[model samples]
Target: TQLLEQSPQFLSIQEGENLTVYCNSSSVFSSLQWYRQEPGEGPVLLVTVVTGGEVKKLKRLTFQFGDARKDSSLHITAAQPGDTGLYLCAGPTNTGNQFYFGTGTSLTVIP
Candidate 1:
């Protein structure tokens, strides 16, 4: 079963553009993590949003956790070619026993 669903599975944009991708799930989670994976490499953790309705910013990237703690969004500002990669959101099950990863959003930032 798919625990997490990510919107806009495929995205292609020009440099200096902005974009937002979403991750949603029915079950509530205590915390959620966002990751970015480049071609032929492992995913690197971007940030972990723990509290409900929390917003975190890393450079030009922004992450927001839903007020209900069941959804999240990632927004990128001033996209660059170096930003091209797959963005994935992951979280633990309600019981905190297992983890689930979103289907992912593929981002292509053309120079």
Candidate 2:
């Protein structure tokens, strides 16, 4: 079953602007992870927000998990061209044997 959904499948913004991408699901997760994939390399883990209502920042990128642990958001401030990539969120299945990933949001930042 499709467990995770991400919004705005695609996004393009000018440099220095801010943007937010969302990930939602009907099921609650024990922990949620965000990843960013560049052109060729594999998706790199950005952050893992475990607790509901928790927020974490990685430089200009900010990540937050919903209070119910069923949603999450990634916000970037003063977005730069280097931030262009495909953002994805993943959560382990109830069985804890595998992970379900979001559809993905491809972001392009114009310089």
Question: What are the models' TM-scores?
Answer: 0.96, 0.96
Worst 10 residues of 2 by lDDT: 1-10
Candidate 1, residues 3-111, lDDT tens digits: the string is: 8999999999999999999999998989999999999999999999999999999999999999999999999999999999999999987688888999999999999
Clash pairs for candidate 2: none
Least lDDT summed over 10 consecutive residues: which range in candidate 1? 91-100
TM-score of 1: 0.96
Q: How accurate is candidate 1 locally (lDDT)?
A: 0.96
lDDT of 2 by residue, 1-111 (tens): 568999889999999999999999999999999999999889999999999999999999999999999999999999999999999999998788999999999999999
Q: What shift in Å separates residue 68 of candidate 1 from its native position after superposition?
A: 0.2
Alpha-carbon RMSD to native, per candidate? 1.0, 0.9
Q: Candidate 2's C-alpha lDDT?
A: 0.96
